[model samples]
Target: MCYAKKLNFKLKTCTTLSRVNALSSVAVKFAAYLCTIDSPDIANDYLKVQSLQEIAALIGTTSRHLNRVLQKWTEQQIISRTDDMIHIKDWQAIQEISEDIRFV
Candidate 1:
């Protein structure tokens, strides 16, 4: 019983860490995408089409989970969303969130 409990605890911890790492990676890449806000890559007649499902697939996660992460960013005013489009409210903050990585 003791061994089972230890193993379960380790497994849960590993799962949690994996989720955190994955979410961090997604956040970084998402910020990079936002950097293209004014370019043709994101601009479609001045509206960026950023689909949650597409981004989730790129980040190797489900859209439902990615949505939660995005919601938190939205709550903090990091990004604004209108339907499937998104606009970065603070590019500098996003760069900081992405650990100062070059967005180009």
Candidate 2:
């Protein structure tokens, strides 16, 4: 490829990777937010947030996408949902998934 074409391809590749990374980050951040709020010390695993829509907005993702992720987590036995509330069943797993991302 010509230099310009090579550069363009590289740019496109970088952009695609960035987008993928960002999407993954959103999930991790959301999980981190949940793990952060639910404290074992308080014996509370339920999320205090009002709605999945609100959390989706906060994480810059669609509510449908958030729900899908939640479903996957539920299947993995990482969490359980009742109505609007989400209970973290595997806090350690979520924390591990969240990696270095921690809530303030």
Candidate 3:
């Protein structure tokens, strides 16, 4: 009976650890996507604050669509754009979003 109880406790601990690892994996994925916001391949260039038209061309998107995306990103505090210039906001804010918008 004593051995059985010990085994059950060990199993519970293992299960809890597995859940933590799973959540970490999800967090990593979220961060990975967020990191792409300032990628040169997307908006890194044209740093002089070019027009949205230029940024759209670089990213292969329409200026209108890019505008909408930018608005949402800004509201989320992920990115900030004034006129044509794009600025990356707090990495911590993005990281916090990554950590929070996760699955169980």
Best by TM-score: 2
Predicted structure 3: clash tally = 0
lDDT of 1 by residue, 1-104 (tens): 39886587556434433444453566775665455444454332322334777556544568888787789899999889997676779878887766643223
Clashes of each: 0, 0, 0
Sort order, TM-score high to low: 2, 1, 3
Give candidate 2 misplaced runs (Cα > 4 Å). Answer: 1-24, 39-48
What is the alpha-carbon lDDT for the whole of candidate 1? 0.60
RMSD of each: 12.8, 12.7, 17.7
Candidate 1 minimal-lDDT segment of 10 residues? 41-50
Task: Please estimate how well model 3 matches the true structure, expressed as its whole-model Cα lDDT.
Answer: 0.50
lDDT of 3 by residue, 43-96 (tens): 422122246674444333477776676677788877787865667676786665
- Report lDDT (Cα) of residue 58, candidate 3: 33
Indicate which candidate wins on lDDT: 2
**Model 2 C-alpha lDDT per residue in residues 7-103, reported as the tens digit of each score:** 8655643443344346466668677666666645443232234778866765568998888889999999998999877788987888888764533
What alpha-carbon RMSD in Å does predicted model 1 have with respect to the real structure? 12.8
- Model 2 TM-score relative to the real fold: 0.63
Q: Give the TM-score of candidate 3.
A: 0.39
